[model samples]
Target chain A: MSRPPYEPPAQSLTGQIVDALLVLAMVVVTLYLPLLLKLSGAGVTKAVQAAPTWESLGQNAVMAAQWEKLGFDPAKAAEIIGSRFDYSFSWGALALTALVIVGYFVVMLRWSDREYRDVIAERFGDDRPPRRR
Target chain B: MTDITPQNLAGVAAPAAEPVARRVALKRVLGPAHVWGLGVGIVLVGEFMGWNFAVGKGGAIAALTACWLAGILYTCVAMIDSEITSTVAAAGGQYAQAKHIIGPLAAFNVGLYLVMAYTMLEVSNAIVTGDLIEAFTHNMGLVGEVDKRAFMVLTIVFLAWLNYRGVLATLTLNLVITAIAFAAIVTLFLYVRPWAPGETLKHGDLLTGLPYGGLGILAAMHFGLWFYLGIEGTTQAAEEVRSPARALPLGTLTGVMTLLIAATITWYVGTGLMPWEYLGQAVTPLYDAARLTGSAPLEVFLFFGTLFATIASANGCINDASRAWFAMGRDRYMPVWFGAVHPRYHTPFRSIVFFVPIAILFAVSTPLDQTITLSILSGLLGYTLMALSVVIFRRKWPLGTIDRGYVHPLHPLPAILLLALCAVTYVAVFLGYGSQLLAMMAFFIVASLWFALHRYKYVRRGDQFTMRWPKPNGY
Candidate 1:
């Protein structure tokens, strides 16, 4: 019902560094959690592997069926599709690496800042802080 | 509202000034949900189309990685944008905020970029919508299929009509269509189950090789950018929203979270059901996902769903683009006619009208991928300026009782991070389209030249606003 007093908290350099580190840790966990699970023989890797492959990457069952129905070997058509689907995943790890770093910055800002938490409560919650009797 | 400008406050009797000041305005009818609808809706087309192209350039693994990175970048930017827009809720969105924090030149460039981004996106959606409709009808065995150009022209006109009607109509239409599009995605997840049925999924090892390698992911950045491209359009509704201080932040955060989830499902499950390469080439991607199930009616449902999604996105673009035009016109940054509102409709009728023909031209002439690239290019420019504005605001405005709605946490850190991501995106753009960057530079040069030529008119007439500390209470 009432707005909070406007006082931008002054975060010291050390406090800022601590917050940054905390955020970095969260980012590392989230960004790498899937890969870690895969490395640990979790089903996520299998599921990811099950995603449509480059060999058959561009051919749907219908397209393959259509090709087969047209008297062309479905395998040949799929191979052709695979060859054309050209984007390689060799540097995909780098993308994940980038994700980890960016994710760290985002999660850090969202979680580590005290003012942001209060602001969230004010915007989304009851818009009022508890009152003293 | 016009009284906020220095020209009126100084009682300038300039002959060029019209009595339409303050008289031409939009009514505040939007609430928090409307904001969410507009935010999510303007980007709904990205869910249905455009993103899959990245898969062709980068394999599934590379594309997925690029997509998530973009998602994180946008999430960070949106969080900061939420705070800034809430602090200064203006219809002009980033342009208005930039004017107060930076200066008129920054505001002018930012405004041009915002309008360019929204309108070009509108054109891209129109182009894609026309393609999807043609593909769907031809597949449906319809006797007479509509030509893509004619279809685009009609779609543009129809959307302009909806925008010309009013904000409430536009938002309501967007809400209904967005809900349907979201439901379609959920239904796709339920029915197709891309993650499951493992053996049926082929080419599983393709995730291991990045064909173009590390830099390929950067080339695919625009594709990832597609998922959440226009989410910032929500801020453009600040002047039309009821209690924007509470609603803008709530709406943007909610919308961004929802969009992130939607993007994840779209990238993972949609590609999982169909090969990413196929999705890359398909005109109607969601329709193809339905067709993969080998169900005729489901495909039809998704065809309509994709249509609805495109309409919602294109409609939102018209609404937001018109407002940006209106704001710029109000500031005398462009011709005053663009700022004029239809007294009857209380809408920026001229602004809405002007974009339709240009959008149709692009929709007819430009390739979908190129249109998308240009749209994202404008968006990156706008985002870069906005992120810079946040950094400037932090250094200038001492947080106090100055109607401060929300101050972003960690102060300059988020802004710095956003700027870094933006810099990386620019690098990716330059690397991908080395020659195209020159064209953008030329466009910017032309815009600056025009601004320089006209800067004195507003200054001489006291029509321009000067930058001040603390942004003078409210934007």
Candidate 2:
């Protein structure tokens, strides 16, 4: 079936703002929720997969135990989860993500003004022409 | 929006210099996000060995040194490519632009080199993922062992099927994969926070010598190089992006720096606790880390993350390789069938279909190490050509003509130095790829022979693919 064109609502600016704000809030939650869940619990589904049978899940659990010997701590019992099964590893990982995100944001914002790179670029002469194909 | 008519894009091949009336889709050139996707994808496949190598055999100092060196090399390449990107954001990207300077043969070579490189990358990625999957399976107690050959076939079939849907499908795949993989990294990061407390500020130097006399900084460089592989991939997506002139350079920088920082942090925390040997031996080190953290959720996250890394990378390979092939076909170098876009997908579906089986066969047959070494060789070779091409293109058109208008700063130095350093790095990495140089030599021979046969065919048809290309003893 041919798809119909998307039509924007003929509404006031309020509608757009409301929609955008909703999206923004959703973004923040999505960004941090996964981290929070990971640090807090060990029962969360990993990700979307070709849904496996219960048998497969059960088998995987047995295998997960073997892995614990190799280094995988299901309850994060060793280090990440200091409590009986406290999962702090998940939180530490969150901190790491924050570092990367901040670094990326800072670099991008600084470069956006196109000022900082000028000194290095200036060495190349005024050959810096704005080209649009 | 105007609907696409049958008349638009009617011919599979159009004039190389201009887009046919309907062929030009009004979209933005690639943004930083696309570039990051491509780079990450390429690295995921292209530099699997380096990642493992740093963890396993390389010394702490070696790995650290490599990271710094890679950072410098990547920065230079980014600066150099930005100029070419600005000039030809609308031209045939690297292909058309290079043809203008070096002529048709070299142009054909560039496209062909790209195809070969991406194909190798996909196979390499599958092989790496296979290794990771094997570990995951063993951890799950699902099997006695995982056979690489079987895994290769599975990975190839899955990737081909996924890519058969085209660019959006692939992009969707890339985004999902990146998100999951990022999550895994986050999990590992969190686990390291309460690490052997009170030892945080002890190490004065980042490049501390490895315990038990390890590989030192070489391992770090290897991983660094691996991580930086696809940083400039956004250039190829110029035809589909929005305001690439503003986006490409900045995006390239953003994407690479993100991975760079991630690798650096991961290395610091990861190696700090686990022995490099233990880390190296792990089929899935991140997963191992997750397991060690004693978190069931993190374990699953790591497993799924590896899956995403592999799948997203495969999608990226398909998208990038197909586009280059399409360009080649349109230019009369490859079969015209490679140029045809799917009506529904608006993708070079035929090219991707052709590409997948080849990758599958190689992935299934070649040893994972061999596949990895060859992929790096292939990618580095293409990058070397691109670096050189940038220099030549700049020199040929010093007074760069402005259409929509974007330009580079200097003509000779940036391009010249980039090519020089790229040449040195390319050769060094090539040597670094294998214990024996014999296989590397053999691949070169194969590439050379293929070029020769193509040249002979071109001559017979009285249509030299190198009509304008520089003939360095028919190189």
- Indicate the DockQ of the complex predicted as candidate 1: 0.02
- Highest lDDT model number: 1
Residues A19-116 of candidate 1 have per-residue lDDT tens digits of: 33442343234222322343211010111223344233454454454344323464444443544422223345435434543443343233323222
Structure candidate 1, residue pairs in collision = A53-B202, A53-B203, A88-B209, A88-B210, A88-B211, A89-B209, A89-B210, A89-B211, A90-B209, A90-B210
Candidate 1 docking quality: incorrect, acceptable, medium or high: incorrect
lDDT of 2 by residue, A1-133 (tens): 1112222224334643453244234322432233234321111112222444323333233334333456544433222212111111244544543354334324323332232122112222223445610
Candidate 1, B1-475: lDDT as tens digits: 2233322221223232122224345677789999999999998788888888677666667778878888878877787888778766666888777655555566666777787788878988888788888878877789985888888888899989988987788889899989998888888767765556553333452233565678667767757788899999999998788777788888888888998888877776665555444555555677776766677877887887888888999999999988987888766666555678787777889889877766776678666766676678788877776776776576655666244566667867777777887867765655444334434544654555555553324421222322212222211
Candidate 2's residue-wise lDDT over B212-286, tens digit each? Answer: 243333323434566566656666676665666666777676776767776676666555444443444444556
Query: Candidate 2 - CAPRI tier?
Result: incorrect
lDDT scores in order: 0.66, 0.51
Ten contiguous residues minimizing lDDT sum, candidate 2 chain A: A79-88
